[model samples]
Target: MTLILALDFGGTKLAAAVTQLGSREWLRYERRLSPIDGNATTDLAIMRSLIYSLLQDATPDAIGVSFGGPVDFTTGTVRLSHHVPGWENLPLKDLLEKEFAISAIVDNDANVAALGEHRFGAGEGYDSLFYITISTGVGGGWIINGQPWRGNAGMAGEIGHIVVNPAGPVCLCGKQGCVERLASGPYMAQDAKEYLFKPANQLQGQQLRSLVNDNLDLITGQIISQAATQGDELAIKILQSGAWALGVGIGNVANLINPQRFILGGSVTKAGEIWWNTVQKTARETALPEIDFEIVSAALGDDAPLWGAVALAESALISK
Candidate 1:
C-alpha cells in the first residue's frame, strides 16, 4: 500500500511509523527511546534500524523526520538539543537520503507536531493556531493557513526560549529565565525539589523519579502530578507556579499574534485542568481580554510528532 514513512526524534525517545496518507488506523511501526547518555550516533543508528524494520515490506516512497531541536530547513541540519549531546548542526536529511536512497525531509519537532495536531488532532479546522509543548523543555510550533510556518533561518516559534524572568534559573539555551527554565517539566520538578527540600531526598539529580520516601529519585513530574491529584500541597504549588509562568508566555504570544486557538501538549498537559486552569487565569490577567481565543489540550498523544513527520514529507513532495 502507498504510505509515508515518519520518524520523530525526541530527547527521551525515538519513534518511527508507517502510515496511510489520510487515515489514522494505517499507523504502525516500532519505537525506541534513548538510554541515559545516548548520543547522536546512537540515535541515528537506532533510526536507521527502525526504518528498515518497519518498512521492510511497505516500501515507502519518502522519509520524514521531525527533530527535537532547532533545524535548518534549507540544509536540514540539527542545531543541538538541550537533552541530547553531540547533535550540533548535523546534516540529518542528506545523511538519511544517502543511507536509504529515498527522498527525506526534516524539520523542528514542535513545528511538525503543530502541523500534525492542526491537520488531524485538536487544531483541526483552525486556520491559525499555536502549539506549545511543556516537557523536559518547552517547545512551540505555529500553524497559519493550514500549514507550518518555518520563518527565515527556520527558527520560528521557539517560544520556549522567550525570556520570562531576567533573574530566574538558567535555561539549557545558556540564557537565564527563559520560559523553558521556568515552566517545563524538569523545571517543575526542580521547583518542587527546592521548595520541599529534605536533606535525605533531592529529585533534581535524576531526570525522573517516583514519589516515595522522599528519595528525591521518586519526585518526577509524573509523581508530582500524582501528588497533585491527591491534593498534595507541594505538588499543587509547584504546578501552579509553573502555570503562572506559562500563562505569561502564552499571553505574550496571544498579545502578539492572537491566533484562533492555542493548543497545549506534552507530558505536563496530562495534569488536565491543573495546568489549564492556571493558564486561563493567568492569560486573562496578562493578555488583552478583547482578543478572542480558545485554549485546549492537543488530541494527539505521543503520535503527534509522527503525524507531523508525515506532514513534512507530504509538504516536501508537493512542493517539489
Candidate 2:
C-alpha cells in the first residue's frame, strides 16, 4: 500500500500523520506542542520525533508540509515566521525529499488549509471560496474554479494584512489598523490589557477583571469571549471591534472576488453567537447590496491543515 505523510508546523504545535493512498483516515498520527521559545531547529526536532514514531519501519511514498508562515511554494522554502524565529528561507521541501528519499510538497498553512476545506470539508463542491483562520493570527486562502490559487510570490490570500482602520493600532507588520492588528487573539488581548488601565474606562472591564482575578496579563481572546458572554462591557466592545474588523475585511474581499462562500476557522471562531452574529451582520452591511455570500465554520477544525497536507501530497504523486 502506498503511504503519504502529512506534517503541520503550526505556530504553537506540531503534528504528523501517515495515511494510505485514497484513505480518508490516518494509519498513524502523532502531535505535540512546540516549545514556548522554539525556533526552527527545536520545532524540527520535535517534528522528526513525531515522524519517526509514526513511520517506524514503514516508508512514506510522498510527503506534504504546512508551515505557519509565508513560503515559496515552487521551492518549498519558508520565508519566515512571525511567532517562531530561525525559520527564514529554510529549504523544507528539499530537506524532506533528501531525508525520506521521496517527493514532498509544501505551502503556507493558510493555503494548505484552504485546499483541505475545498477537497473534503467546508469548501467541498464549491468552485470558489475563501478560507480564513482567525487564531494566533488572521490569514486566508483562496479557491478559484475548484483549484487553490497561490498568486505570484504565494502571497495572494493575505487578508490579515489588509488595512481596515488607518487610525487604529499599529501591527507587527508596521501597518496601522490592519485586520490582524485588531482581530488576532494576541492583539485583542493586548488591546484589552491596555484599555483596562485607562482611567476614563474605569467603569468598563469590571467583569473582565473579575474573570481573570484582576490579572490583566491573564486576558486572552477566549477570556474576552467568556467575559462578553457574562456581560462585560469591555470584553464585548473588544470582541465586537475584532469582529467588525474581520467583517470589513471580508466585505472588501467579497467585493473584490465575489466568492460564493467564506469558510472561517481557528480558535477565535469559537467566540460563540455574538462574535458570529457581529461578523455576519457587519459584513452584510459593509458589502454592496448586489454581492451575496455565505459565511460558515470550517468543518475540519484543527485537523484541516493535516488533511490538506494529504491532498497536497496526492497532488505531488499525480504530477510524478
Candidate 3:
C-alpha cells in the first residue's frame, strides 16, 4: 500500500496525517496553535518541523497541503488568509516540495475537504456536491464529478464574502454585510452579546445578569448553543437568526449551482439539528421552485481536511 503524508494548515491548529494513498486508514496528529503573527519564516520552519516529526519513518511519495487561504493555482501561492497572518501570498507548494524533497500539491483547505467528501464521504455517488462550512467564518467548496472545481485562478470557493445585507455588519474583507459577518462563529458570539444587553426582557434579564456577574468574558456562540440545548428561547432565537443568514447564503449558492447535495460542516455545526432546521426552512423558502436537493451534514467531521489533503496528494501522484 502506498503511503501519503497530508497536512492541514488552519488558523487555530495544524493537523498532520499518514495514511494509505488510496484508503481511509490513517493515524491522526494534531497540534493547537497560537497566532502566527505574520512571521513567515518562523511559521514555515514550524510547519517543516511538524511534518518531519509526524512522518519520520518514511518519506511520503507526495506531500499534500491544504492551506486555509486563497491560492493562485497557476503559481501555487497563497493569496491571503484572515486568520493565519503569515500565510499571505506564500509559495506553499514549492516550499513543501523543497522542504520534503518530494512532489507536492497545495490548494484551498475547503476545496480539498470538498474533494475528500465527494470521493469518500457523504458526497459519494453524487456527480456534484457543494460543501459549506460554518465555523469561525463561512466558507464553501465545490466538487464537480469527484474533482474540485478550482476556477481559472484557483480562487473558486470564496462564497463567504458574498454581500448578504449591504448595511448589516462590516467584514474583515472591508466589505459590509458579507455572509460570514452574519453567520459565522464570531458573528454568533457577537449576536449573543447584543442579545444579553437587550432591555430587561424576561428571557434575558436573569441569565444575562448571571452570565455577566460571573466575570464571563462575554456571551459566546457556544454558550448560546448550550442555552438552546437547555431550552432557552432567547438562545434558540439567536440560533435561528444565525441559521437564517446561513440559509440565505446557501440559497444563493443553490440557485447558482443547483448541486445534488449541500454538505454543511465545521465547528459551529455542532449546534446540530437546531442549525440545520433553520437552514433548511430558509433555504426552502428562498430556493427556486424548479430546483431541489438535500441539505445535509458533512460525514467526515473535523478530519475532513486531513483526509482531503491525502486524497489530493494521492490523485496527483496517480496523475503524474
Candidate 4:
C-alpha cells in the first residue's frame, strides 16, 4: 500500500498523519500542542516527533504540509507566522523533501483547508467556494474551478482585512474596522474586557462578569457565546457587531467572486444562534439581490486543513 504523509503546523498545534493513497481514513495519526513560547525550531521538532511516531518504518510516496501563516507557495517557503517567531523565509518544502527524499507540497492553512473541503467535505460538489476560518483570527481561501486560487504572491482570500467599518476599532494589520478586528475571538474578548472596565458599561455585561467571576480578562469568545445564550446584553451586542462585520465581508465576496458556497469553520463560528442569525440576516441585507450564494459550516471542522494536506499529497502522487 502506497502511503501519503500529512503534516499540519497550526500556530497553536501540530499534527501528522499517515494514510494510504486512496484511503479516506488515516493509518496512523499523532498530534501535539505547540508550546506557548515555541519558535520555528521547537514547532519543527514537535512535528518531526509526530511524523516519526506515525511513519514507523514505512516511507511515504509524497508529503503535504499546512502552515498557519503566510507562505511563498511557489517555493514552499514560509514568510512569517503571526503567532510564532523564527519562521521568516523558511524553505519548508525543500527541507521536507530533503528529509524524506520525496515530493512535498506546502501551503497556508486557509488555502489547504479550502482544498480539503473541495476534495472531501462540504465543497465536494462545488466548483467554486470560499472557506473562512474565524477563531483566533479571520481568514479565507478560495477554490475556483476545483483548483486552489492563491493569488499572485499567494496573498489572496484575505477577507479578514476587508475594512467593513472604516471608522471602527483598529486591526492588527493596522487598519480600522477590518473584519478580523471585530469578528475574531481574541478581539471579541478584548472588547468585552475593555467595555466592562468602564463605569457606564458596568451593568451591561452582568452575566458575562458572573461567568468570568469578575475577572474581565477571563472573557473569551466561548464565554461570550455562553453568556449570550444566558441573555447577556453586552455579549449579544459584541457578538452581533462581530457577526455583522463578517457578514459584510461575505456579502462583498459574493458580489465579487459569486462562488457557489461559503464554508465557515473554526471556534468562533460556534457562537450560538445569535451569531449565526446576525451573520445570515446582515449578509442578506448587504448583498445585492442579483447575487446569490449559500453559507454553511465546514463539514471537516478543525481537521479540514489536515485533510487538505492529504489531498495535496494525493495530487503529487497522481502527477508523478
Candidate 5:
C-alpha cells in the first residue's frame, strides 16, 4: 500500500497523520496545541514528535506540510509567520526532505486548505471557490478553474489584509482597517479588552465583564461571543463589527473573482447564529445584485489543512 504523511503547522496547533494513498480515512493521527510562547524550534520539535509517533516504523512515499505563513511554493521556503517567530527565510521543504530522506512538499496553510476543500471537502464539485479561515488570524485561499491559484510570489488570496475600513485601528502589518485587524479572533479579543479598560465603558459591557470575571485580560473572542449570546451590547457590537469587516472583504472578493462559493472555517466561524447572520447579511448588502454566489461552512473544519497536506503529498508522488 502506498503511504502518505501529512502535517499541519497551524498557528495554535500541530497535527500529523498517516494514510494510504487514495484513502479518505487516516490510519493514524495525532494533534497537540502549540505552546503559548513557542517559536519555530519548539513548534518543529513538537511536530517531529507527532510525526515519529504516527510513523512508528513505516515509511511514507511522500510527505506534505501545511505551514501557517507565507511560503515560496516553488522553493518551499517560509518567509515568516505572523503569529510565530523564528520562521523567517526557513527552507522547510529542504529540511524535511533531508531529515526524512524522502520527497516533501510544503505550502501556505491557506493555499493548501483551499486545495483540500477543492479535492475532498466543501469545494469538491466546484471549480471556483474561496476558502477563508477566521480563528487566531484571518486568511484566504483560492480554487480557480478546479486548481489552486497562488498568484505571483504565492501571495494571492490574502483577503485578511484587504482594507475594509481605511479609518479603523492600525493592524500589526501597519495598515489601518485591514480585514484581519477588525475580524480576526485575537483582534476581537484585544478590542474588547481595550474597550472594557475605560471607565466610561464600564456601564456598557456588564455581561462581557461578568464573563471574564472583571479581568479584561481574560477576554477572548469566544468569551465575547458568549457575552453576545447573553445580550451584552458591547460584545454584540464588537462581534458584528468583525462580521461586517469580513463581509466587506468577501463581497469585494466575490466581485473581483466571482467564485462559485466561499467556504469558511476556523474557530471564529463557530461564533453562533449572530455572527453568521451578520456575515451573510453584510455580504449580500455589499455585493452588486448582478453577482451570484454562496457562502458555506467548510466541511473539514480544522482538519482541512491536514487533508490538504495529503493532497500535496499525493501530487508529489505523482510528479515523481
Candidate 6:
C-alpha cells in the first residue's frame, strides 16, 4: 500500500492527513488551530507534531503541502504570508524534502484548493472553474481546461488584490478598495469595529453591539453575520458590501476568463442568504449579459486544501 501524506498550513489552522494512494478517504487525520500569536516556527512545530502523530510507524512515499501564501511553485519557496509573520522567503519545499527524506510538493493554498475542487470536489466534472476562498483573507485559484493554471510567477489567481473600489479604505497591501480589503472576514470584522467606534454610529449598530455585549473589539465576521440574521442594519450593510466587492471581482474575472463555474468557500461564505443573494445579484449585474456562468459553494469546505495536498502528492509520485 502506497501512503500519501498531506499537509495544510492555513492562516488560522494546521491540518495533516495520511491516506493510501488513490483512496478518497484518509487513513488518519489531525487538525489544530494555529496560535493567535504564532509565527512560522510555531506553526511548523505544530504541523510537525500532527505529522508524526498521523504517520506513527509508517513512511509515506511522497508529501504535499498547501501553504496559505504566495509561493514559487517551481521552487516551492514561500514569498510571504499576509496573515502570518516570519514566513517570508522560506524554502519550505526543500525543508520538507530534507526532513522527511522523501519527495515533497508545495503550492499556494488557493491554487492547491482549486486543484482539489477540480479533481475531487465541486469542480470535479467541470472543465474550467474558479475557486475563491473568502475567509481570514480572500484568495482565488483557477482551473482552466481541466488543469490548474498558476500564471506567471505563480501569482495568477490573486483575485483578493483586485481593485473593486479604489476609493474605499486602505488595505494592508497599501491599496484602497482591494477585494480582500473589503471582502475578507477579518476586514469585514475590522470595518464593523471601526464603524461602531464612531460617535455618530453609536446608535446605529444596536443589534451588532448587543451581539458582542457592546464590546466592539469582540466583533468578528461571524458575529456580524449573527447580527445580520437578527436584523442588525449595520451588520447587514457590512456583509452586503463585502458580498458586492467579491461579486464585482468575480464578474471581472468571468469577463476575462469566462470559466464555467465559480466555487466559493471559507467562513464568510456562510453569512447566510442575504450575503449569497447580494453576491449573485451583483455578479449578474456586473457581468455582460452574454457571459454565462454559475456560482456554487465548495463541497469540500475547510478540508479542500488537505484533499488538494493529496492530489499534489499523487502528482509528485507520478512525475517521479
Between candidates 1 and 3, the lDDT winner? 1
Assess each prediction's global lDDT (C-alpha) against the native.
0.82, 0.94, 0.78, 0.93, 0.93, 0.94
Q: Cα RMSD (Å) between model 2 and the true structure?
A: 0.9
What C-alpha root-mean-square deviation, in Å, does candidate 3 show against the real structure? 2.3
Residues 167-228 of candidate 2 have per-residue lDDT tens digits of 99999999999999988988999999998888887777888998889888999999999999
Off by over 4 Å in 2: none
Estimate the Cα RMSD of every predicted model relative to the unseen true structure: 3.2, 0.9, 2.3, 0.8, 0.9, 0.9
Residues 1-320 of candidate 5 have per-residue lDDT tens digits of 99999999988889999999999999999999999999999999999999999999998899999999999999999999987999999999999999999999999999999999888999999999999999988999999998899999999999999999989999989999999999988899999888888888778799988887888999989999999999999899999999999999999998889999999998999898999999999998888889999999999999999999999999999989
Tell me each candidate's TM-score.
Answer: 0.92, 0.98, 0.91, 0.99, 0.98, 0.98
Model 6 stretches astray by more than 4 angstroms: none
lDDT (tens digit, per residue) of candidate 3 on 1-320: 56788888876677777877657777647564744464556656667677778777777888778777777865678887777666677888887788778888888878988987887788989998989888887888898876689887886777788887898878888998787887787787786676565555535624533655633456666776777777767778878877888888878888998989999888878886787799999988878988898988899998788778887788778888
Who wins the lDDT comparison?
A: 2
| Model 1 agreement with the true structure over 1-320: per-residue lDDT tens digits | 55789999999999999987666754677889787889999988898888888877667767888898889988888888767898998999999888767788998888989998987899989999999898887888999887788888888888888887888888877898888887788778777777656656553333223346646645777777777877777777778878888888888889999899988889988875786899888987878978888888889888889888887777766776
* Least well predicted 10-residue stretch by lDDT in candidate 1: 202-211
Candidate 3 wrong stretches, greater than 4 Å: 35-39, 195-213
Positional deviation of residue 313's Cα in model 6 after best superposition, in angstroms: 0.6
Off by over 4 Å in 5: none
The residue-by-residue lDDT of candidate 4 on 1-320, one tens digit each, is: 89999999998989889988878888998889999999999999988988888888888999999999999999999999999999999999999999999999999999999999999999998999999999999999999998999999999999999999989998999999999999999999999899899998767788999998998889999999999999998899999999999999999899888998999999998999999999988887888998889999999988999999999999898888
lDDT (C-alpha) at residue 9 in model 5: 92
- TM-score, candidate number 6: 0.98
Better of 3 and 6 by lDDT: 6
